[model samples]
Target: MNYDRILAARTSRIKASAIRELLKLAANPDLISLGGGLPSPESFPLDLVMELTEKVINKYGSAALQYDTTEGFTPLRKALVEYINAKGIDAGLENIYITSGSQGFLDAIGKLLITPGDYVAVEGPTYLAALQAFNAYEVHYAQMQVDKEGVIPESMEEIIQSYPVKFVYTVPTFQNPSGKTIGVQRREKIAEIILKHDVLLIEDDPYSALRYKGEELPTIKSMAPDNVIYASTFSKIFAPGLRIGFFVAPEKLGRWLVLIKQGVDLNTCTFTQALATEYLTGGYVSKQVQKNINLYRPKLETMLKELEDNFPKDFKWCEPDGGMFLWVEGPEGMDMEKVYKRAIEKGVGFVPGTFFFPNPGDGIETMRLNFTNIAEEQIKQAIKILASVVEEEMKITSIN
Candidate 1:
């Protein structure tokens, strides 16, 4: 019963995510949760999924249901190669390694490259799951500052110069939590710094295809191909449940990643991979992306307008061109955790920003709001309720 004594010490490094735990409360009808970065069920290409499933059954038969290589289904890998190459990255099936999801690729990188106390650099308010994945390996994280254009290149260079980092992790395009896209100049600057220092970079880019505005900026992977390990997923554009993700690394690292992957899950689901291959190759992917943009853009605009109209003048938030979240910062002395509790009591829930920071206390005055999961009407209502909660919380904090 007392398993703690027998458990590995590495387990101590892991902590349950506050947002994930809060998300469990979402099933309560009273909760209008924005805590989880989940896509709208409405956005999933359900009709296309049914069609693809039938196609897979017709084409692959029982092989679609069978065990597969750790490197993923070859057809999926080949499709991803063509996809990436089209994106202007010189990748091929040989350079691509598929995992259960992009999250798996994160874990694999953590497993392969991170030793206990290894230094990893991340954006100040980065993806909580990534921090969690790397933490299990007992890696020490250093935070780089971020601005309107995502991670500040000067801060990144400073961190790399000051520390012997194993790799610099970035969600450069439409980054999670922040929703700030790294601009072209910043991307170029980052590429130059990484090459000059010969540091490895892990570019987690699950949101690039979701762009609804602005010109597409080149991926950091394309800029410094040799030093970058690029990971992407169909989860954002297609369906999350399929859990299909791929990575492009140099041949040496790609081989090792596949080997590590084999020990973990043997391979991703064969049927799912086959389905995704069809989805991508069948010309459905682009139409689905456009559909997502059509549905989400107006909702995001609604939230932004509501925030502008309702929130206190001092409260700051980003205007992301695309992505699922908007990062908001309350007044300097305000406690976002307390505010989150108040918001939940008012039937609105959002992720407190502190959870995104590797150093917990640093982002206490911030929170992340997701606009994609809810409808336009619900978004307006939720923001109104949230504004009321913020007003009440600020009044209380002011009195205190």
Candidate 2:
């Protein structure tokens, strides 16, 4: 059918996701997968879901099933006001807008702001799906340096100074792939830099509510209200299948985002939005968050302990306070992709870290491991198996 000949030029910039392909290997029931950023089935309030649905049906009636405004369902937006305000974000209904999921906002924002050859400043090893979203618009990336604290404010300033970047994107709170939280001072510095440069920043925070051991950090959005667009999802705290995510941006930008979303999907989902409205307004969030923490904290601790006991001395990983992943870095010249293949063959799977970087050839010495989805004992088994693969790779690297 030679469809390639008729396809748009922009399609060439998009590549198949390496993590998605690797997950296929993880589908084998015997494989202990530390690959996907999936929440534990136990974390879902499945018993509460039916009750919530019934409440939605009773409360909103026909409107719950009917089409809604491009912006979002009104009651859900209203309910989120008190919800986000607690996090220190001063947002009103005008500031909040919904999308199919956070992924939808990522794609819409890319479509809204990006022109071909436009540069976006991102951390060296940033969220893989973000790069995938921006790539379709043929966007270029200006890589920013990161340490254990997530994005360095100075590196961000340097990138902004060096490149004609359209915008800056960051997953500042318990960031994906890296599980590093930017501290309050760094958040202030980042806010200062963005405001000084008069640039927009996207704060992709999907994991802040899953706190395990640290004090809650202030959001970058609160630190720089006018300069940052804050986006989050119900995937972690609630359920992923609902596909309900929302953003708080300046009213002007929010309006445009809604307009842009109109062409994509008329609205996120009326019934789901109704369900979210009830969930948020019914005081279910905190209890659910605590339940998730109780379920995941031990698994995270188990994985950390297993790594300390089993992994090679030179290998290190971020001990995050709360998040779904841990970023493990092997010594220099160690390629984690080779380790991933070996681990998969041994019935353990993880994502090779290079896939997370916007630039090719970066983060080859690393991999990302997920603890929430796997049982504690399985996490123990997977880490032990994965460590052996890593040790073997280290020995091979030493010899070669």
Can you write out model 1's per-residue Cα lDDT over 318-394, one digit (the tens) per residue?
A: 99999999999988788888888777777888888988898868999999999888888888899889888888888
Worst 10 residues of 1 by lDDT: 18-27
TM-score for candidate 2: 0.98
Candidate 1: residue 384 Cα off by (Å): 0.9
lDDT of 2 by residue, 183-278 (tens): 999999999999999999999999999989979989989988999999999999999999999999999999999888999999999999999999
Q: Which ten residues in a row have the lowest lDDT in candidate 2?
A: 15-24
Question: Model 2 residue 154 lDDT?
Answer: 92
- For every candidate, C-alpha RMSD to the true structure in Å: 1.4, 1.2
- Deviation (Å) of 173 in candidate 1: 0.9
TM-score, every prediction: 0.97, 0.98
